[model samples]
Target chain A: MANAATTIDSPSEATIRERIARHAGAARVPDRFKIIADTSDFFRVDYNDVVVLGERAFWIKGYEKEGRFGLDDELKYWVRRAIDLADGTTTILKLVFHEQFETRIGEVAITCFRSPKKEARILDLVADHPNFMHGRWSRDTAGNIIRILEYIPGRRYDEIIAEYGAGHEEYFHRFFPRVLAEYIELVQAIKFLHDHGEKHGDIRRDHIIRDSERQVNRWIDFDYTYRHGESMFGFDLQGLGNILIFLAGRGDVLVPDLYRDQRQLFDTLWGEDLNISYKNRVANLKKIFPYIPDSLNRVLLHFSRGAELYYETTDQMLEDLATAQAALALHTGRGS
Target chain B: MSTQTFGDLSRRDVERHLLVAVDESENSKRTVMYLADFFGGLKDVFITLLTIIPEPSEDFFPTEAARAKWLRDRRAVMEQAMAGYREILRAVGLEDHQIESRIVIRPCASIGAAILEEQEKRRCCIVVVGRRGISHSEEFVFGSTSNHILHHAKNSAVLVVE
Candidate 1:
């Protein structure tokens, strides 16, 4: 039983609304944007909103916030999507939203933060690089960055692997070599960033979009950064390893999933064969799939329990991968 | 001063100089103790206590004042720590002139690289550092500063005191 005129509301609803309004004021593009309508949930505007940047007007269409389920309220509110009214092309609009977090890899704890300006700087640096998403940015009256990134059309490599139909054996023999080659190219692109004293910060399977039209694997999302220290690119390097495991295993092949699907293959795996960081997951794929060469398995072992030495740079990884490629070539020749 | 040539060390006219890189960690204190045990009361040995304070990137802080405050606080802490280290070396019979204390505040990507650069500039025969005590997994992912110094230091003998 409540008062007749009293509208029920959460305790923090008013606070959230106030905070959002403050952020929205800072992110205002002034004469460039017109708010057509408002979304019921997070985003600032609804469908078909008009945003004028310089001489171009983009119509807000759809959004692609991948971590919608996990993202905090503050983060979800800043990201947006729009389509170019003149060219009929889509673009991702990222507004400034600051967040900092501490993460550890083994014993080393690192402080990472979100920096929209840094991402804009990276975009400018790699503007012509084919393997990276292209974007241009401008600052608002409050000095908050507003980036308009070209929405590259393609499916994520993770989804591509998840929907792949061929069995592991067939895929390994028929297409794994090509996958390896493409991965090398991807690593080279990362090396380019490293050479320029920059880090991708976030490197995941889904962040890699395979643009079939461009025939390139383009990396997106560069807003994350960490305090530079002994392990400057540790997060990115680890992320690359995870992606390799996913692609090589033909998707995430968890221990329980493998046991349920193929008891024989699961039986072949030992505790040491699993990833030390992720003990429940298989790392030594050569144990289950014997066709996986020892050289490549050794590289994978860098992320597993059997590792003697880990890669310090992309150059070392590339060198080891080249050796694996040579071995694969010899094996293929023998099979022919 | 007596010019003594240690085993396999090239003959030199000047006194032997050692560059000891230190921070405010317990491991650094241990390294200082180890140096006192070995090189203490050796009047000919010159020790340069070097501490490199990496200036925080501008993007790391919300404002210029915050970044400046961080740098100032870091410099103050390191300066005090360096003074204590200097006192310990001085008590061990090393003259005040023989021990040179340097605190570098600059944008550095790698502390190991900065140490190596200082070693090259100062022409120190030996570079000493406390082992960072990183686990195998940590070493694999983040890399070891001591390991980097060990492999990359040129024209200077590296001593990683554990």
Candidate 2:
């Protein structure tokens, strides 16, 4: 069976369409296409399926597995990988999916939604810029906006951190400086977007990929948008804090679990040091890791429940981050 | 022992509630004019003018006094506009009891979502908004309030007046 499929030439669009109709319900039909997932019948592309948009057709290779690209699980239903038949290059295909929901931070209620159209706009603005995913979009027969992004091969930043296999104390001294340098670059990239009047609505540890070829962090996914006009970039600011906490703490330090298992570390932390949105997660790392300088710990406090002030803009944050970096240089003589 | 049925039409059953979301823009005045020309002098229809003032969090400003002063100034301006809108409806033969004005001061992420919440709370059957003449590029990137309402408002008929 493998030999027979391998011998066959790349099928035409018409032939591929017929195979899709023939194997409508069947799963794993040899070399034929199978609809691996369907979302409310709005989008139904799957492994081995051919997606035609405009004059170009892309042959589906497989669905991008969750955590592989740090792709959010919620977005998995609409995102897949394919081989661009024209150029024989790989691409990431993002299908149109509508999702809107609300969340609350203290007294403020925020409405967040998925916007493929906005992402397409952002791609155009950052087409030539490094440290951003490159892509273009087109409408399908159903009027659904389909985005084809050139694939960036690399491990997610979180995946790299997890593979480091070092204790927090060792990682802090040996590798934390390198992470901070990369984070500074990431901040500049975000600043570029802000300068262009765009926001990377979804910023997380997994969304940043350490490109194996370029050897730099490249941010992916800018489709999430939240309604907060008072501070237009408020959501992205909070996202930056979350990444800092994740990177500094070496991962999430669940306070409740710590209290139950390791009472000593839990006893050191105050209730006010917890994240404003996630009450059980610790935000102030200095209480546990005394090695963390006061300069840097002060920045993390802005995202905590006991915060007296909040970051208003990226420029403001970069100023404080510079001070923190200077203090780190004094101690370790590494990242000055 | 008493069975008296006289067409079974109560005041509540005959009333049609409309929630019109407005701002200080000139387009909002046109919306009011359109409403007056279409549904004016209708005894059974009730209109509620809603103006949402998104109050930023205390931390958003440099000082508490700054935040307080900003809120006070914003409320004053919006209250004046709401009063004017209320008068426009009253002039069209909508009785004092039939016209209601609401100025909400709260931390709202989306004005469109906030308006829909009030619509659901007041059990309004129709929602009215003024088109802002937003360009396609601007609407594609920033999203417009009217578009958000037209897409997300549930169980209510939405009307957008230019």
Candidate 3:
């Protein structure tokens, strides 16, 4: 398996050690507890002090970038703030995890850690994708494991809504095509994970981070990530449906809401079920506002409609999303 | 009740901690069931059921007995409201220790703020609440609790169960 520590192909054992050596100075983190950056989202990680999540403390033997991203034996939430000494920028650090079991064996409080092996395997399994967060781990003198992960400097989905979604129906309308593409990338990101024989156990809007600057999406918190087996990938698909609705609806305001009512837009993804026929799905969405592009509605139905507009695989879902994206461009009269 | 507190839930190994804030509305009761079905499958989850009640009027009683009765009555009603949540959690296979229900009393009665406060204290990853709890007119005048949490709960994911 390729190393989860390095993004490119295998960084030799020496290479990994050298990269660690280089980053050690970059992530020197002046004061263990201090603000390293002052961006708009500074408070997002700054307000809260370094909370180890579950445990009171865990030690890190090497630089955070060198620590493997894996499960620990003790079950506790630990939040670490780290700075990139090279760029002097800070990113919040959290680990992809496993279930830690605590047992009472005689009088001793025996706590066993989750092996880092599974996380390493999963990272190697999905190594081809740059969107998945890279993880490394290090242990302190006490043997407490410190797992490290990629920290993207981007706003969460909710923050986007709060900043522009409050009363901006026109903004969403003008950017409908762009929104469709972003959603498409989101679907593709998941497809990559699913195609790689893994499933993101938990998929929420917050987990689908938007790197606006890079114009890309990254999935985080692999706590629920596991190898795909017999599942149809329905859970995450439906979750994407839910996310689309929330974004389109701009969140439910009891006073007739802003997004849906303002533009006469339909809540196509809301309460969608497999039983709903594809034609009816399109019809229902159109009834709300006739201008809703048929192509866009069709794509929505593919996920919502069980048998008729159904997609068997996410790869298929990705292909049709491309078609939908092209059609959306024409509908909104925008270039792809 | 096992009296298992959510405080002891392992933060490191926590699959997810979901906080559902409900009221006496049937929709609120349904919220618990919805949560049970949607997020119930996770093996290592902690569900905190929270309810907010109006603070008793200081002038409601001229005598100590009246105050006692008032407090007792409020507790009884809140406990009765929470019973359905307990039943649903049990029915869904959550261990006794995994379920926690708390009733918070605030005289000002800002249910939304209280819910956010509880979320902060517990650090719940998700906050699920019922959308039908307040009337449309009330929402227009007072703003809905769900909206307040939706806009303010930056770190915690907000789910409005309709």
Query: Per-prediction RMSD in angstroms?
Result: 9.6, 16.0, 20.3
Candidate 1 has an lDDT of 0.74
Backbone clash tally (model 2): 0
DockQ of 3: 0.01
Model 1, A1-336: lDDT tens digits are 001111222223233333333434435433343432122223556554554443344566565567422352333456678765446566787767777888765345668888876798899988999999998885533455667788888887777766554698877766677788888888999989988888888787778998878978889888888875566776677778878887788986789988899889898887777775566778888877788889988888877766777676788888998998778767654321
List TM-score per model, in order.
Answer: 0.82, 0.62, 0.42
The best-first sequence of candidates by lDDT reads 2, 1, 3
Give me the runs in candidate 2 sitting further than 4 Å from their true place: A1-42, A65-75, A104-109, B1-162
Tens digits of per-residue lDDT for model 3 on B83-158?
8788888787887677788888765335677788888888888899888754322232234568768878967789
For model 2 chain B, give the 10-residue run with minimal summed lDDT. Answer: B1-10
For all candidates, state DockQ relative to the true structure. Answer: 0.43, 0.03, 0.01
- Show pairs that collide, candidate 2: none
* lDDT to native, each model: 0.74, 0.74, 0.54
Model 3, span A1-336: residue lDDT tens: 322222223223333333334655435422334221212122333432232212112122222221122342333333455543333345444432334444321121223233343444555555566566655543322223344455666777655765553353553456656666777777787787767645565566677667666657777655443211112354455456546545544442221342445443433334343212111222224334456666655655544433243343577667766876777677667743
The TM-score leader among the candidates is: 1
